[model samples]
Target: MIKYLLNQSLLSMKKRYDYDVTYMQDILRTDLGAFMKFMAFQTMSTHKGNLPVEALYAARIRAIIWDDCGPCTQLIVNMAVEANVDSVLVKAIVDRDLEKLPSAISLVVRFTELVLAHNPEADELRQQIIELWGEKGLITIAYGICSTRVYPALKYTLGHGKTCSRVVLNDEPVVPKKNPQLVGSHHD
Candidate 1:
């Protein structure tokens, strides 16, 4: 596990969160209360609406991949899986096989990529996003994508980032259909 050096003031914030602040919370709060509020806004703002959280998560995965923030990439991958995103969808995202994804979700990924790359074609993609997601949904998705990018720079600069986790990215089946220990073992 990556460890953050927290000071007395940060410790107080951690205590308020029941001493269970997330990795980003610990690091951002290290700066001061205002920075923590900024971080909070980025994460919480989009979550206030009924937008598809899975699509937002998918967009995040794509953004972090483009940013080459390994730890954030791995963290988002784990989160997507835990959120019960379809394994096939998660695999497609991890594999960067965008064509394998549904057009609706893949549109968000492509838009995020183009935006981060600052390609002029991103405007075209943004238009497409607006058509599919509506202006409000487009705004939500765009904000979510941009917001997620900030954490990678922070973690990478702070030396808290790691190479993307293979265990998290691997497409290997996480749950066994049958218990290996129970195979050929006597059971009532």
Candidate 2:
């Protein structure tokens, strides 16, 4: 029901949500666990303002997605590791002088905790992170800022401490199949 409702909401949002349904279904057939994680991660990122750096965190975090659990785990791990490297080192890998990854990743992990735990964790996490990240990293953050609820306020919100982007539902969740009684009631 939640999945259907969210899909309907996306449909109403002017063809902006363009996740490939068939591809997602295929993944659902193959490995449901990873699909659930990906879906949960995206869903948690969308509605919750608790996700730190709220906007940029989701954008950077979603840079990679895969069909396989192993690959998906590695992709998320890579995102985590990228957050720990120096810009010069990262620049060597991607041929760009990007310095935002470290801060973005750090905040994202912190945001993850905020989503799972709550405000107390967020406060402690924020305090510990105050000196590590600065204004530029915050400014460069762009993805998750304009989440689903905020989508309706784009024209007014844009350039006013808000962001605008395509909103995609994570993936359709799988309903476990229930076993059927053998045509009629069976005697024990």
Candidate 3:
């Protein structure tokens, strides 16, 4: 009975976003307990305590792009758009056009990049995030960054992930820029 409801939910999501959910289906079929745990972890990504929708989604977009360049990235982009994040800001992040992004979002992009790259240079940026949004805000952004990576990782590990594909925004296809400027660079 629970699986029936879960499948209905997943089907709705798949239809709404035009996203593939075979990995999630596989997980559900293989282990109900693991699927439940995975769904619980997904809740962590949705908590944006005190963050501007733009800042939180920026961190999520950046982190997902770091881990994936294909369907997973497209899913995040689609979700961000649905949440009403500014389309221009979403494009800038997708294109890695740091120059076009506002200061707050630029900080988030660079910070997410540095954190993903395992560079300690993110320390100063972390301080800035806290100053602007408090500890909960920082935590929200951290969760955004961390949780976005899991879907792609799980998909690929399950052999259900795809290679890079064009991402569509507002009905237009966008070729996301690869490796744009990061912290300590002239763009900053």
Model 3 Cα lDDT, one tens digit per residue, 1-188: 99989988999999998888888988888899999999998789788788999999889998887778679889999989999998888999998898999999999998888888777789999999999999999999989988988888888888887666878888888877656444334233
Alpha carbon deviation, residue 105, candidate 1 (Å): 1.7
The model with the greater lDDT, 1 or 2, is 1
The order of the candidates by lDDT, greatest first, is 3, 1, 2
Query: Which candidate leads in TM-score?
Result: 3
Model 3 residue 74 CA deviation (Å) reads 0.9
Tens digits of per-residue lDDT, candidate 1, 1-188, equal 12244345456755543322355565554655655576467565345244576678777777766665345565566667767887678767666566898887777766666666566777998888777667877777777777777776756666656554432445463221122333333222
Clash list (residue pairs), candidate 1: none
User: Which lDDT values do the candidates have, in the order given?
Assistant: 0.62, 0.35, 0.87
Please say which candidate is ahead in lDDT: 2 or 3.
3
Q: Model 2: what TM-score?
A: 0.25
| Best lDDT among the predictions, by candidate number | 3
TM-score per model over all chains: 0.67, 0.25, 0.93
On the 0 to 100 scale, the lDDT of residue 180 in model 2 is 32
Candidate 1 vs 3: which has more TM-score = 3
